[model samples]
Target: MIGYMYILQCSDGSYYTGSTKDLERRLQQHQSGDGANHTKKRQPVTLVYYEKYDRIDTAFYREKQVQGWSRAKKEVLIRGEVDELHRLSECQNDTHWLERYSSAFGCAQASNIIKKERKKDN
Candidate 1:
């Protein structure tokens, strides 16, 4: 089964990150106010980004990683700004492989697609 990590951009301009086995159902719950407390008050969030994982642990860990990020970092993730995301993931000092895992993911691609559509909308 595919587990997923998702990010929601709430009406208040805040972001929520979470992992769930059922992406569609989980999103429904969030929209229906059956989601977490943070989201319940925010009411009416829009799904901005998501990543599917083969393992639940992977999805959970990714959700945590995103949750710990600063708002700008999360925006980079949400916008699918691959170049910026890689820069953010890189080590400030000289160190290889700091962003290896993150860079390998296709998040950048998805982000880019979303970015374009949003541009067309505007």
Candidate 2:
């Protein structure tokens, strides 16, 4: 069945992300202090954003993903800044393989070196 992934802005200004088959009922529960402990403790939350999904699992998955996101990334989603999501998704200190190799030699030169290494191995 269809389900919803939703984000709520708590009275404390924190965000809560969750998924449910019944958005209205779930929201009511949160407002009434009968929801998850996190929301119950931070009562009086306002629905900030939501996305509908064809499958309950999909909604749940999205909710988990959103819950793990940083505040800035979440804000990007709330503001409907789709283009900024990718850039925001990147971890500041984490480096990709290409980035690590390219840091010493420029990107184009690093790429050529990697290609040469691969050819040598083959």
Candidate 2, residues 1-122: lDDT per residue as tens digits? 99999999999999999999999999999999999999999989999999999999999999999999999999999999998998887654424646877998989887787778779979
The TM-scores of all predictions, comma-separated, are 0.72, 0.78
TM match of model 2 to true structure? 0.78
lDDT at 9, model 1: 84
In candidate 2, position 88 carries an lDDT of 84
How high is the CA lDDT of each candidate model? 0.84, 0.91
Poorest lDDT segment (10 consecutive residues) of candidate 2? 89-98
Predicted structure with the largest TM-score when compared to the true one: 2
Cα lDDT tens digits for candidate 1, 6-118: 99988898999999999999999999999988899998999999999999899999999889988989998888898998888766531233244336645665456555756
**Span of 10 residues, lowest total lDDT, candidate 1:** 93-102
